[model samples]
Target: MPKEKSLVKNVMYKSLLSLFNIVVPIIIGSYATKIIGKDGMGEVFYADTIYQYFLIFGAFGIYNYGLREISRIRDNKEKLKQLFSSLFILGVASNIIVLLAYAGFIFFNYKGTSSFSIFAIYLFSIFSNLFYVEWANEALEKYDFITIKTIIVKLIYIVALLTLVKTPEDYLIYAGLISVALFLNNIISFVFIVKDIGFTLKCLTFRRHVKYLIMALIMANGNVLYTQLDKLFLGSNLGKDTVAFYTTPQNVVYMINAFIMSVVYVTIPRLSNILAANDEKAYLKLLNKVAKSLSLFLFPAAMGLTVLAREIILLYAKPEFLPAVPVLQIFTIYMITLAFESILSNQVMYVKKREKVLICFIICCGLFNLIAKIGLTKAGLLTPVTAVMTTVMANIILISLEFFYSTRVLKVDIPIFKLDKFKYLFISLLFIPITYGVKMIFASTVMITLVTMILCGSVYFGILLVTKDEVVIAILNKFLKRA
Candidate 1:
């Protein structure tokens, strides 16, 4: 058996990746969007909305299938090589389609292209991503390399976008920067993947894997539905203004959700390897440990933001975006739900058949969300935020069922649903008073925000220490090397 790395290294690496992909990008991107007013910001988002839908279609589930399969058979170098070959060959067809789609978009304004001349940039982005997608660094837990690549990419992105994008009217510059940054990043990642893992072009083949490929495709296509289709529908139905308002919260929620999932993201490949080996004890222990650990980490971020929702909204966003703060707070509740589902969904792909379970789950949820958003919006019963809450609830129900199914398949006891059941009750009973007390001492806006963050985190950790939480004790002992 391959010796797995320790948990601390994995979590640190993934968190670093999250910082590169998220924290830097958002803070920098926010500056640009601020320079462009809400309406101008709205235009960039409109383009983003279009790009996201394309991303969904372009991806076609290859990344997930590739990761899980690679993890399951990491020790078998020959087999892994062939799997990559098959995947790479199949990816070529998808790449061509993506390129043609970009071409059509540029030539005919195929829905949301910036200008006719920037097709080269679009091609560069899609092609580079196609090559990069075949890498299984995420599955194999080489996040040391992943983090490095992410940092380099973000730098390239920030520099190119900021320098070249002189005006909102200069969308071509913006598009080119995005495309080039993605291409360069993916290229760097591709080089490492080839050198490290070896996607031996000759050994790879997918001709006989159509059944598996089709299953992966169904799941991949369905994923687009759960992730991005709503924005497209919103644009078509409610127009650009609604798209702007709806997407603002969605952007923040999605970024936060991605950050929240990084913990589980680091764990899943190991989860897969253990399941594949029939290591029941290891698998169950991993799942339970991961769920609880993530629950604790995510609780503070989610709850902290909800507490400071009004101030946070006013502090960061323009007035037009006030609509998104309450919307975002509602999503804070949904964040926990989405985190649970992401972790459990890994089990679905790992323990059971990923492609099948995901397909059924996303389709049902997507259709329900569409119906819910449409009906509620028409009836004047909800805003986009409220519609999101409805969708979030539906996701919770669906994934909860899948979690149980996977647990039953693995023959493990159900978790206490501790987060849903007692998390809020516990946080409220403990943290609210302390957080409020911190707010009073630091009256300045900047001072309060800074003090609040440090104090809230310190108090939360201290409370966990006092309560004798085993996880806290274990983490502390590991860090202090005093065990």
Candidate 2:
């Protein structure tokens, strides 16, 4: 048997990658917004949103499915090669189909328009997906490589962004640079993956994988609709500027959520392998740790963002985006919802092979979001604030359904809302008063934001240490031993 990589190292590297993902975007977005302004940024993001929808179809559920499948057979060299080739071929075929469809859509709807150029640039990303085999590396638990490569590429992308994009009209250049970054990331991964697995189409088989792939496709579409449809509606009904207002704050919340969830994500393969060996006790034990860790991190993150929404908006975006304050606050609720939803849906459902049930839950939530947005838009009440509130409600519904199904139907005991989890919430609530108190003394937005983060983090972890929270204590002990 192949030796298992250390989960601690994987988490550390994934967290570092997440930090770069978060910080680089903030840096690029802040600079880009200042130069491009709302409308410019809005148009680019709007196009990007549409591009994301098509990209989802292009992916056709390969990443999630491929990761799980590859993780299962990774120790078998021949089996791994066959699986990777089959999935890679499937991905390439799907991308080509989606790419053609995207071109047709652009030709029909956006042809001979100024927006055509922007959409055309995003088209390269679809082709880039042809080489997007990061799923295989992830299945092999290659976080160190993934992280280092991403940091290098992101640095190069940042340099290009700063040097090339100087004016509002340079949004096209911004779009192209994004595609180039994606292509570079994908192609590099592709070369490494081919070297590892070797390319072969001889043993490819598709029929047996079809059912699960379909389920994955449904889940992916439902998720995309649940997350992205609001932006589409906001852009169409209100304006692209409205999309910016909504997505800017959302981007911040998502960045934080991504960072928090990196810990959970790196565990997926292990969770799959644990379940595969019928190690029920080990699976539940690891899951409980994930739940506790998410609570420990997510509550503070949500609370801090809620309290510092205004300062963060001002710090990262133009003053006109102040309208996004409430949107940001609303998304704090989503930050929590999305994290637990991943536990329920991705880790539990996907690992347990309960994809059909998970798909139903997500599809229903997506429909709810669509209807609510349409209702709000028709009522002339669909501002960025209202749009995000609707999304949060939809997310709550999905999580509630998922929890009920996991516990009652599937009989999977997830320690989601235990007293220990709420302990984190109760402690994190201190951020509100503490942040406001600091705000009363600090005159500058930067000072308030910075001070609030520092004080809140120190106090939250300080209490955790005092109480000897198991998760915190274990982490600290590990670091101390390493030191």
Candidate 3:
């Protein structure tokens, strides 16, 4: 495949899979909610989210760092092995550390967390999630193998989940069983990827690789914390069903965010390579192109979702989840902020100056989120809405801080909140009429949704073209020229 096509493959396949990752969890969670009742469902979800918080530790930044490093050194088998082995060792240690920490949190109740046994099962899920590292193959631009593996694993997960999960009576057992399936999936994925990629991971010393692992550990925790900590806090302070209520909106917004980040993640290795070669002009050009391209899609999508979040949420989920519609709206706004922040974060990390700044930023954001959420919840605010608002505000703060730092590092005025964003802003506002019309049409929800989605995209793209927005035109020219 040609370069652009190859890049598109990674972004698109992962985009599709990310959708499953988001949708499937919600389906399973919702199913459990029906069978187990809101309270029981919330307890299981709480365990899962809590486990995920520690899963951040096992991840330890390898998703970004490993992909970049492995791509750069793909030709050197020994070095690749060394890097892989070191990251693997660090991941294992991190998982153990997290498990031990879970024990402590369990013993102390960490402000009334759930039981140690439940957390322990969740610990199993964290280990299984590490198989996501096998995505290093996808990052290496080996799509077919990873896609195939993902299909198998995802199918197994869906099948296992469907078969084992039935009633509220066995909710926790079902949850733990699902975790076992995930571990099996990961193990199988690792086996297939090592075979397909043909890399040997041999004896590696932690002493030599400790520095990279430490930086990676810090970066990984910061990244995951920014995304998942709110859910954890909400589950702990507010309630688990509240966690479920928040999940719908967060997942929807996160789906869009995942797609945007997927595109950026796929390009990072290429970006890093260009930077390594000191191709200054090319780096800036690529960054500008990516930022503009990402904004064109992300901005309008987020804004439109913010506009019609109610319709989308109520349409997909049952009536019980109707409360999340407003929460989804609030979270969609954060997705917008995150859209901008992602571009800057990638640029900063590409320069190797991101770790410290990003860590500090996540800490501030998490603290702000915690404080705000506590106040809002205490003030009789609903957990879903309060958590969503708190998170959006946190993201906005992070964006401002990042924009300040990005300008210095890139030596260019990098407003992640791009100017052409107004085009999206304007077009998004037009969705109000479409939404109102859809409400009055008296059509089946299916037909209404299909038509509204079409209208929204049509109007958004038409407005962008008519305005001759630079980002749209540039992307059009690039994509069209290849066509």
What is each predicted model's overall lDDT from 0 to 1? 0.67, 0.89, 0.68
Among all candidates shown, the one with the greatest lDDT: 2
Which of candidates 1 and 3 reaches a greater TM-score? 1
TM-score of each: 0.89, 0.98, 0.85
Q: Order the candidates by lDDT, highest first.
A: 2, 3, 1
Q: How many clashes does each candidate structure show, in the order listed?
A: 3, 0, 0
Per-residue lDDT over 391-482 for candidate 2, one digit per residue giving the tens place of the 0 to 100 score? 88888999999899889987888998899898999999899899989989999998998899899999999999998999999999999999
Runs with alpha carbons beyond 4 Å of true place in candidate 1: 105-123, 170-172, 201-203, 220-223, 380-382, 407-410, 419-425, 428-444
What tens digits encode model 3's per-residue C-alpha lDDT throughout 253-334? Answer: 7766776666676677777666667787787777777776676677667767776676676555667778888888888777
Q: Which residue pairs show backbone clashes in model 3?
A: none
Q: Which whole-number lDDT from 0 to 100 does residue 475 have in model 3?
A: 62
Candidate 1 achieves a global lDDT of 0.67
Deviation in angstroms for 229 in model 1? 3.2
Rank candidates, TM-score, best first.
2, 1, 3
Q: What TM-score does candidate 1 get on C-alpha atoms?
A: 0.89
Give the winner by TM-score: 2
